[model samples]
Target: MLRAGQAREDIKVVSFDVDGTLVSPGFVDCVWLQGIPKAYAEKEGLSFEQAFEYVKSEYDKIGEHRIEWYNIDYWLRKFDLDIPYERLFKKYEDEIMIYEEVESVLAVLEEEGYELILSSNAANEFIEFQIEPIKRFFSHVFSATSDFGEVKKTNGFFARVCEILDVKPQAVVHTGDHWVFDFLNPRKIGITAYYLDRARKRNVTDEVRKEDDEFVISDLSELLDDPDC
Candidate 1:
């Protein structure tokens, strides 16, 4: 089931990784662990359990390698929250779910012509309200921290997403659920990465990188069961 490039019909562009591989890390963990600490506990009158432990210790003092930690307008202007990231994305945007194998695997990879893309580090204004119910099955939506200021997904952001999808890192193919920005930064350059570990939670790629690289894939319909995918 791991037969990459089965007969090499030249896999043209397939990247995807919007929140836990096409939606459902409970809308970016309910907009950063309960909508920015319930909008800083209604502007510092404090108590959504003490402003989510003081906005999760100021988001662990700026973690996620700080591109303003994936910038929801830089935490609503760093908690000067007069609230308006579109009313905290219309109150958690119903905690966007979207991953029952993501619209039948993006309608079987855009009906098998394969040109979907959404390669994310989530910050095109938080991928536009959870990518608006699959955003017309993507022809491009990249936002390694808002379209390549890259605070994640390096390998020079998969070589500038194969130089703006003029495709050639082996014709591209990516999956997600992050084992180093969706599996070792787009397989470090030659694309064709896949490592979606859906709650099989870390075989840790057989303990750190390429031990005969099975190109793991807990399921996006097993990327259409190979057949020269």
Candidate 2:
């Protein structure tokens, strides 16, 4: 527990994943999932169904864990899409929004003197645009492509963040929506991990129920009340 007026020495860094954690997934879903498919369909003169299938197939080939999966330029080249990637982002920029409870939680964290950082798998350009609404809360932002040259699924990526922050791995408490990248990988490297499954979408097996490291939670407000954090 933090003492009154303490500078958060127990948790030097409270790192957050940008997409689906602090912010809504609308922008990414529009650009990558919906916009890309729609554009592909129009470009190829195919139905939306066919284009979605093709895009899903291509994404499956690369998978979400790799660095290339998050690269817009790579996808543009692979699919021969002629539009500038920034234009796609601009189209959905207004849709980019933070969770209702995010700003309040961030305010509390900051008030308690914890260092707030954004550690995301999103591209730097994407992070830069989405964070304008809540940028003041963050001391620094780290992205997979621009900062790490590796995806968050790689343990090295989180390790590199700890290195860059000049803090011990365990000193950071990372909260995010991904079970692996946000919780598993960071926990493996000794960082405290909190799995933010707001939708409660994860299937809970008997084994999963018994795991000590996976601190599954449904909202950011829970963090403010959790004494252990």
Candidate 3:
């Protein structure tokens, strides 16, 4: 766990991982499978879970870009379902909601003069859908699918963010939910890190968990109490 201390005066920028970090309503993964695919699968006489699994299996073999394309249009054709892409997107939009304390935390950070950037693994459309609600908070928003061609967990992603922000790794603090992808990897590259264990959803091994610089409160409101900020 990270001890309480003042933030470095030289730090000028902060980057965050989206999805489980900021606005986690918990429906993204399950909805893509059960809600979106299942609706189509049922129309085609296939079991919903089976349809979901089959599409996922196909995605795993073809790689991430293929999955991005799948997000655009392939699922309907692949499953022989008649749903339009726009309607499928709406289902996800309606179900999406922000996390408990995101606004308050962001407000505190913005008032501190830190330039905020959103680095996420979701597709461009998904990011667009989310930005509508929180557009005022970030200085820049980037999606791995649209901006980098790979997720933040991969090489070149963090480097790209550093390059774009024109800041060094040590000068920025990264916060996110994924233990390996968000915390460990960014720390390995010299960036400071915080783990947002919102809802305590992830169970990581002690060795890996120890690497985090801080375990921030689950609610964004707690950020107001952060002595460092």
Reference-based lDDT, each prediction:
0.78, 0.83, 0.67
Best of the candidates, lDDT: 2
Candidate 3 structure quality by residue, lDDT tens digits, 1-229: 1223335666677778878777664546655666665776677677877777776786677665453552555555766667775676677776677776777677777887888888788776666676577778888887777777774455367778888888987777777777777777777777776667777655545544464324544554543454755
TM-scores of the candidates in the order shown: 0.34, 0.83, 0.78
Model 2, 26-112: lDDT tens digits are 888889888888889999999999999999899999996778898888998899999988889888988998899999889998988
lDDT-sorted candidate list, best first:
2, 1, 3
lDDT of 1: 0.78
TM-score of 2: 0.83
Give the C-alpha lDDT of model 2.
0.83
Model 3 regions more than 4 Å off: 1-7, 42-57, 60-70, 74-77, 80-84, 201-205, 208-217, 221-229
Alpha carbon lDDT at 172, candidate 2: 85
Superposed by TM-score, candidate 2 places the C-alpha of residue 117 at a distance from the truth, in angstroms, of: 0.8
* Regions more than 4 Å wrong, model 2: 1-9, 203-214, 226-229
Q: In angstroms, how far off is 124's CA in candidate 3?
A: 1.6
Clashes of 2: 0
